[model samples]
Target: MAKLHLIKLSVGTETIESLRQWQAGKQTQTADGLPRHVTRMWPKRADELLDGGSIFWVFQGMVQCRQRLLRFDEVIGQDGIRRCAFVLDPAIIPTTNALKRPFQGWRYLQPADAPADLPAHRQTEDELPASLSAALADIGVL
Candidate 1:
């Protein structure tokens, strides 16, 4: 296990199920290296991010799912800014819901702080309403 990555989803694209669909769709496209996301800056800990790390996705302001980090590359934007292109594997692993505040950029997710992956049989709850799940997790009753 290695340190992970955390990213806030853009508005209207926050559901864990939606994330799974997105990952699936991306895989259907020709394998263009790895699935990439544009970011303002490249992570300094690229080695750590690629070392058996997963990207914890914050959906609807809560942690929902993760994807393995295949790699990260630097991409220069049209405006000449060097940006990070996070290359992620297509598999979206569900995780127990965890609350997170809105943030401007992706952050490092320590292995210890990242939520445990939901077991295959337990992934049914992934479709539950975020509010209900968050409340349950808050009380340690989820």
Candidate 2:
């Protein structure tokens, strides 16, 4: 089966570097030192997600980067509720800037719909302004 993916808004993040810095903190990582994103709902298709899937991050209204989903761990809050912790690879891969609307939570992203990873040469280029990127994406230029 084709690998599945998830897309979530990187709230409060202004750039990909900011997101990398934020995740670098110890508190944002699992006990084993992997980055993680805790969520209220566990994915029903965990197997597919674990089959080389990634968590695509939406920064400033555009899909900017992704981290591979390594595993799901169950975590309980002090409030005594169970939640899913998406243990992620530490490597943050840059992607072609794809425009996305504001959303409340993560959504499933099919392989066909996910943005392509930026070529290695382009990944080193200065990041484009969100508006310009969005306009390019809107015109299918991204």
Candidate 3:
């Protein structure tokens, strides 16, 4: 059983290249004296998420890239609150553009509902401007 993992559209990440740099820089946050990307509220279906799930990042009103789930850890923050640390594989796999309404926090994504990974040959879209990409998508040219 796979589960969905979601991240808010990054405020600073406008392009995939920028996201790659951001992600490279995002990996070293300290959690419980160790490095991890932890979020509040441990997911109830951690097993399913760890089984075979990717954290889908929402970008520019659409679901974009993903990082594979590796493991989960419990961390106690400086405020003495416990959070779920999602240890993820560093690879970011791009996905087909799929529109999504804005929402708070991470949400579970069922496998059937997850966007398909973009094909390797269809990588040219990354070179286009966001608006041009959107226009091409709207015109079925992407």
Candidate 4:
């Protein structure tokens, strides 16, 4: 099974607006798409999840990629309240060696089940981390 990682990333003002617009669009498209419970839980959970020393997974396509640490912040939302946001720093890296297969889509893995002692270097959202390189070495990702 794919490991999950929670990443702390700051959503820019533009990104937040875009997300809101996307959510609005989705709401119009299908009533049963995203549940209200999930939406309500996201903010509070995000606050807790972004606490210090959190780890998250990174992904390229459908495959697991690297991991990152979460750095929390508060940004002004459209409503003008300082709200939670996160910043990502690499915990792992994705590379040809790390991935047993090539990626075909664009999505990231959540940080929850990522391996501890993951290589610290060579991990990046756009590049592989050293830890991931070592992990891949074991699995022949190279």
Candidate 5:
């Protein structure tokens, strides 16, 4: 059986609303988009990652991203130890150039760990393309 998991992706504060609107507009543009009863919800896992100082990286292809656990600091009170947190990194965070539709940005997701439906690429996690690494490093996250 496939392991079910939740994935989280980073989004800009300013672009979130527009993204939401774009998602809604998808139904009108395509016959099959998001379900009518399925409304996108906030309090997303991504928000928690941001609040905890964790960074999300966008990769290419489904199953490309991996899940890892880390600990982050959260202020409980005057004195206390930091807490641990879990977050999902989208396999690929589509960049402007890589996207078919134009928008701020979008995260590629595979509902759960059902093996990525996208094409497969044989590349080790540490063997990222130089361009991608540079882009990530430029953002001070790599």
Candidate 6:
């Protein structure tokens, strides 16, 4: 089966660097030292998600980067409610910028609909502002 992926808005994040800094904090990591994002719902297709899927992060209104989905862990909140934790690989791979509208929670992304990883030469290029990138994408210049 083709691997599945998730796309989530990185709220309050303006740039990829800021997202990196936020995830770098110790509080954002699990006890095992891997970065994880806690969410309210566990994916019903967990089996496919574990088959080399990744979580693509949207900064501003553009999909910017991705991290491999290592696994999902069950987490209990202080209120004793169960939640899902998305265990992520530490490497944040940059991707070709793609615009996405605002949405709640996460959405499943088919591989065909996902943006390609940035080419090595472009990966290190300075990031364009989100609006500019989105505009370029709209014009098919990105």
Model 5 agreement with the true structure over 1-142: per-residue lDDT tens digits: 2212333332321232233343355431223332111113322454333432222223332122333212222323235543322322222322221211222333333333223322344332234454664466556544
* Candidate lDDT (C-alpha), each: 0.73, 0.91, 0.70, 0.35, 0.31, 0.90
**Pick by TM-score: which candidate is best?**
6
Error of 1 at 16 (Å): 1.8
Candidate 1 residue 65 Cα shift, in angstroms, is 0.7
What shift in Å separates residue 45 of candidate 5 from its native position after superposition? 12
Which candidate wins on lDDT?
A: 2
Q: What residue pairs are clashing in model 1?
A: none
RMSD of each: 2.7, 1.2, 3.3, 12.4, 16.8, 1.2
Which 10 consecutive positions of candidate 4 have the poorest summed lDDT?
A: 34-43
Residue 51, model 2: Cα distance from true site in angstroms: 0.2
Clashes of each: 0, 0, 1, 29, 1, 0
Task: Rank candidates by lDDT, best first.
Answer: 2, 6, 1, 3, 4, 5
- The CA lDDT at 40 in model 6 is 96
Q: Residues 13-106, candidate 4, lDDT per residue (tens digit)?
A: 1222233343355422223343111111133344444444343222321133333335444445566666433334422233233222333222
Instruction: Tell me the spans in candidate 2 whose CA falls farther than 4 Å from its real position.
Output: none
lDDT of 2 by residue, 36-140 (tens): 989999999999999999999998789999999999999999999999999999999999888899999899999999988999988888888888888888999
- Badly placed stretches (over 4 Å) of model 3 are 1-8, 26-36, 135-142
- Structural similarity to truth (TM-score) of each candidate: 0.84, 0.95, 0.78, 0.31, 0.24, 0.96
CA shift at 105, candidate 4, in angstroms? 15
Give the residue spans of candidate 4 off by over 4 A: 1-57, 62-70, 78-83, 90-112, 116-142
* Candidate 3 C-alpha error for residue 137, in Å: 4.1
Backbone clash pairs for candidate 6 read none
Candidate 3, residues 1-142, lDDT tens digits: the string is 4555545555567766776776566454444333246678788888888888878877777776777888888888799999888776767788776666778778888888887888988755545666666676677665
